[model samples]
Target chain A: MDYLEKEILVLGCGNILFGDDGFGSEVIQYLQKNYNVPSNVYVDDAGLSVRTILFNIVLSEKKPRKIIIVDAVDLGKPAGSTFHLDVDEMPEIKCDDFSMHQVPTSNLLKELKNFCKVDVKIIASQVQYIPEEVSLGLSNVMRDSIPSACEMILKEMSPL
Target chain B: MGKRIIIQPVSRIEGHAKVTIQLDDLGNVADTRVNVVELRGFEKFCIGRPVEELPRIVTSICGVCPWSHHLASAKANDAVFGVTIPPAGKKLRDLCNSIAYTEEHILHFFFLSGPDFVMGPDADYSVRNVIGIAQANPEIGKKVVRNRHLGTQMLDIISGKSIHPVTAVPGGFSKPLTQKERDKVLPMAEEVLEFAKFSIAFAKENIFPKYLDTVKVLGVFNSGFMGTVSEDGALNVYDGKLRLMKPDGSFTDFAYDSYTDFIAERVEEWSYLKFPYAKSWGEGFSMDVDNPKGIYRTNSLARINVADKMATPLAQKEFEEFRAKFGRPAQLTLLYHWARLIELLYNAEHAVELLNDPEITSRETRVPVTPRAARGVGCVEAPRGTLIHDYETDDKGLITNLNLIVGTTHNNAPINMSVNQAAKLLIKDGKYDQGILNRVEMAIRAYDPCLSCATHNLDGRLPVRIDIVDSEGILINTIQN
Candidate 1:
């Protein structure tokens, strides 16, 4: 489907090459392997390309109605805790980020939510241990949380 | 008292760009350092993995330029496995590189560095961005987005996936382009070529003229240039001999295998990034703009400056005009934008040219390969700069050592030099405004350095928060724009 045709996007946003940092995509993998998400809800592992995908949506003339982000986060909760976080609650991690595209700032998600009028939401799990280097796969704690995260994501998109 | 000022933008993803600028007692710029994250850990991570798997795994390091990594890794693997890919295989790789460059150069020009040139550098932060560009130039914005999407769509059709591509394997491209796929992609390449023409024309007429004054001064510095070029000195990003052009327009061409003899890294305090200088120049290292010793740049501006000519006609014409105007080895950093547009046109033309070749659709893309203990060095001109992936393997084909001198790493010192030059020129007597700071940001933006490629954070955009402090580190002024 064309990107605009999708009403909701469930984007798994993290690199799986890094240990527990792959939580978001791990959930997406679990969903792809296990669940049957409807066509209206587009799901994929965004990985490190999250910013570019989000930037495209913001620049796009027609945006999806909602963007659901699934990623690993450090909320200081239990290692495997999964929860829904509001965009406003996201730390000022937002900045004038510069990659090749040098996509501009506030936070991109916040921009989608506030400026673009898209319902942007996040489903995140506290990482057990994100390796300082490249160590593939999720730790048992983070790996164990994937099914619940997938379930939570499906439940959130239940209206769809 | 001298002051240490830190310009940091917080990002949880990959620790983003952290630039530290030191000020003398008079509040004049003393020094600047573009602090990027380390890649050594990731290098070590590749050690135990199978040599063949590296081409797939390395793409995970940077989302922004995965294709560049994928190709470089594949090339390195080919060198290790001692196999020369079939003609169709080489064409496929070249075609993909050109297409990816088309996508990258367009996005960097229209989205990343667009606003500063289009809206004027001093415009307010809110309206001086991508959304603002869309609002102001709706038609142009649409074209930019559409052309970029077309590039992605083409990559998707060529390779099964655009992001984290594994199509580029050790011996050759894993997949070949079918005639039907080539036919489908041809029109898109032609369309992007048209856009590339419009983009450069638009910039020359509207965007560049307004910023010419700023271009002359901001980030202005003299340094050597580095890039890849074909045998006859034509600009070739996919495969070529490495050229290191000195500040005086003189250059030395060398093979990638002997890159270590020409370039060496100065490990200053073992920071997140390594400072590589021209060892062959034998000037040690320095970022002093007035008398930079061994500093050299690698990116669009550098590529254009070093190359004798562009491979394609339209780009060659644009390149001639650029060289005629700026002279060879342009010192003005802002001209990177100008040089970038020229490359954009080159890639666009190159893509169309590649698509026209019959071999691009050939099925004999891959060749047989046998694993053996070997060391290989592969280099490509990534959109940002020269990307060198050096690797070694055991007899069993397991990786023993690997070092990736990514595009951004080559520009590490020059970025600092540009920011320092910008800071020195703009900030005076400890007084500065958001406009001044944005200009400072603009200098760094001109190179269009991929911070994600630098530090592995896809969203590693630099939201510069400059803090001015005294020698004792007492914060006096903070500018967060």
Candidate 2:
């Protein structure tokens, strides 16, 4: 990865209206407020449609050297447990669907990594729960892990 | 035993859905239902919240077309406050809607639905996607990517943010298009217009003609259509009364706020989505393909069918060409792709036209408003279909009651009917392959239904756990893959 290009992207992905699903977005807000982002790094909250960014990146000639996606997961770990996941580690997913939105995230990420030659990283926290209905806010465990999540990302963002 | 063929997690449209097809003893299709699994409970959750917040909150409903929800909700807020938005403000909203449509339609036509036509419907699944299109045609792929990026950038320049926009405020827009901003985006708008022109031409010459046979036969059905039109009956996506057209081409125009009077939603136990029918039609809603009662279609095909003519010259020409070939109320489901291209051209030209207007940069974009107890309904032609947002507010402007009819939800009945029809037409003798099932999916793709919610799971273990249950709700068989 070209650490000099500053072409690194840190994305926080999830829906803020879907309980613990908002953990990633909340972490992004925390990172923006507390951390001083370097010139080479661009941090954003891609929210529910991160697929748009990943899809564009895959199609475009110019691409970021590295990408770190922050999200919440329920991998049966204790709530708020943070860990790293490579693109290959993600579960297989369906084609990009509409139901007006496709979180075609996993598949798009795989494409970006294997074909686009980009270094992709996922820093996911164990979500307490994701609500089916429109509930807001993260669980206390997930919310408390925001700072730790940001730190983990910052570590990954270190000069390649 | 009658056979049930289930294609779970229908792919490449918006959110995921499932299609279950039933076959009778002779192996011909008996019935079919497309099951949509997630529910946002948007109305119940938003109740008691301040109405102004809806414009922002609704953006989270779907990331693909957040601008539609944002603007529609803002319009509803404007209605509740009873303020006439400034001309400049309305123009800004229209500008955003057109640009968003360009991005969305391009994504659908090239990447999602494009794979089927560009690569052939029976093409191997591995090479039928965005990558396939890019590898096959690199130049068009690059232009498509750059243009989509430009769309988001232009939105960010017009409003403060692009993804979850909060710029459309009650009574008017919060931001004004400065002269400098207008100059910056004008050429970008023209670039998109050039691509739009090329896109429709390419589809007509290369794509549509190749599939004319399939377009005629697959998923054909007779159904009414819905969309918005100006008082002059010209197609206007931003503002207009609702035009609900019958299968025979006769129609009724009703006020936006009076939607409840003409439209009624029917709930089915099997689907998370509701079937909205023409309550004003006097025939009760039914999914019968031979004679669908009160069932009407929305989205691209419906939008064009309901409109008398396109507002832009280029689109109007294409519209005339389309009508000459297919005739009015085109019942062929695949014609949706054709109709979608017309809207893309119209939106691109419309964007260029609006950017040229001097009033678009005027500073008086919004008016002040005080809260009062009132009912308001806002409607817009979302890329998916006609999106309607109705809100009833208390004296404090808190939402007391709310109902939302998303563009895709309007096609719920039509989708099931089309799936049933396609399954019946294609799967004779109960012989079906991945290609056959995917073709049935093509019927739903024409509508371009957006499910509006992400399918969540515990640590990516979705579509992995299978629970086999019997009619008595007993866990008789279990399969985990």
Candidate 3:
């Protein structure tokens, strides 16, 4: 894999301040610490307002060939499994359950897709304890899957 | 030449809404309407869900005030569960509520609503938003952003996220606070406390004076006050009885959980919004001050009035002065913004105190309990007003039914009233100017209604259709009046 072709943008969306739903952010934090990727690869906290991040994508003039969003998707899956999905095919993400400050990155992706030609993907970890009384940390299963999920994402950005 | 207009989908405020204004016979605003449109089916959808799911389910009602919904839902769940949460749970919930208020008010004032006031009312539509705010006063703008960041940061440290918080549970919190997290949260809260203080002082000194004449001359000031009063007569947010005070100083109180007994909702033909009135008081007159019967308002100012006095010294002092100056708890709707800032101070201060408390960090974030067939009512002070969640559940902890009497629902009538008043006030003397009508729109935006959450349906665009009408209610030359 050529270094120049290894361009990857790993963006973690959603507010980490809100309990188990912050799994994506927690995963991003882990990836930031452990992942060894080419210089073209970049990671962003993105936070809860994923919509705001879209502007950077469209207006960057130098558009990236691909974008990956890491978030806690409520797929009713077991706590730890990783689901890689094409942004357009994922279930209609419900932005209501979270905070008002947030517009779903998926929604933002849909909006951006209209104006640009970026290959957008979502890497969502399932959340079982959202809306329940819980801490901000991911569940045990979600936490355990971080390294492997990060590795898979790195692999997807392969052929550099 | 035809005038240009742009209606941004899902107007960037609370809940969901869209704006539409018509051009005059001479390319000016002949009429304007800010549509409070969102068809949320929370009440209908909530029907038949297990009562225990009320807290979690209703928390999705609005991203802005999930904490309020969570509390109201939890309290309703508790009522249905036929068990009262312990004192610590109640206080912790109140603390969470306060944090929610602090975060929301700051978002509304500084980020959402503040832009118009800060960057001239007629600033370019695109730039008059957050980006515009960033360009105009970078220092204050950065401070506003940082203040919100600090508040959300603390919320994340405590509950998980500032929005869609996860700290709340049906029985209680999922986990208790650790000293380290509490310690981390405190200093950040202190910064927010400082910012909140600075905001109050800034309001008193800078912002308040600028809007003083505007408040006195232009804003809606005659609505009655409503809020939750503690058993001991305090401005209790988490667990308390509901109260609706009349403009003439009369009041009614019901068990917080028994919302159905005291309040009845009347839906208007023109709007999907429901206007709640005190069932005891009977119906409301159409914007008539003489026989004001509807449950008028909730949240910051009303909460200040319902409680004996504010717990914090600054808030108490401000509350006293506000009441003294306006006479009987400033009924003016615009003052809610100021009152919200004042409460932000109180909320931040309260959060600081909670964070500093050594016991807050204790590892008992949960209260073990089992669900039973019962009804519960949880009420909390959302940034807009008092939000009540009533739920009935089965023994298995599934929600059987749910009802969210949101703060915006109560203020629905007053919102239309204010809009009508502003339209009339601005359109007087045959003025069809866009700037004049924008002032009227700004007045309505000040309330920050969360109608989308009230209805349970989250999608709708408010295509504002403002038409000029004659004195006899006939359609006069229709324009964006």
Best by the lDDT measure:
2
Model 2 spans with C-alpha error above 4 angstroms: A1-6, A91-106, B453-481
| Cα lDDT tens digits for candidate 3, B349-404 | 77887766666765655566686776666677777777876666677776666666
- Candidate number achieving the greatest TM-score relative to the actual structure: 1
Off by over 4 Å in 1: A93-105, B10-15, B456-462
Identify the CAPRI category of the predicted complex in candidate 2: acceptable
lDDT of 2: 0.83
| TM-score of chain B for predicted candidate 3 | 0.86
TM-score of 3: 0.74
**Second chain TM-score for model 1:** 0.96
Cα deviation of B235 in candidate 1 (Å)? Answer: 0.2
Tell me chain A's TM-score in each of the predictions.
Answer: 0.90, 0.87, 0.78
Which predicted model would earn the best DockQ? 1
Off by over 4 Å in 3: A1-160, B1-12, B18-35, B38-41, B283-285, B288-292, B455-481
Error of 1 at B71 (Å): 0.4
Each model's DockQ?
A: 0.43, 0.41, 0.08
List fnat per candidate, in order: 0.37, 0.43, 0.01
Cα lDDT over the full model 3: 0.62
> 2 or 3: which has the higher lDDT?
2
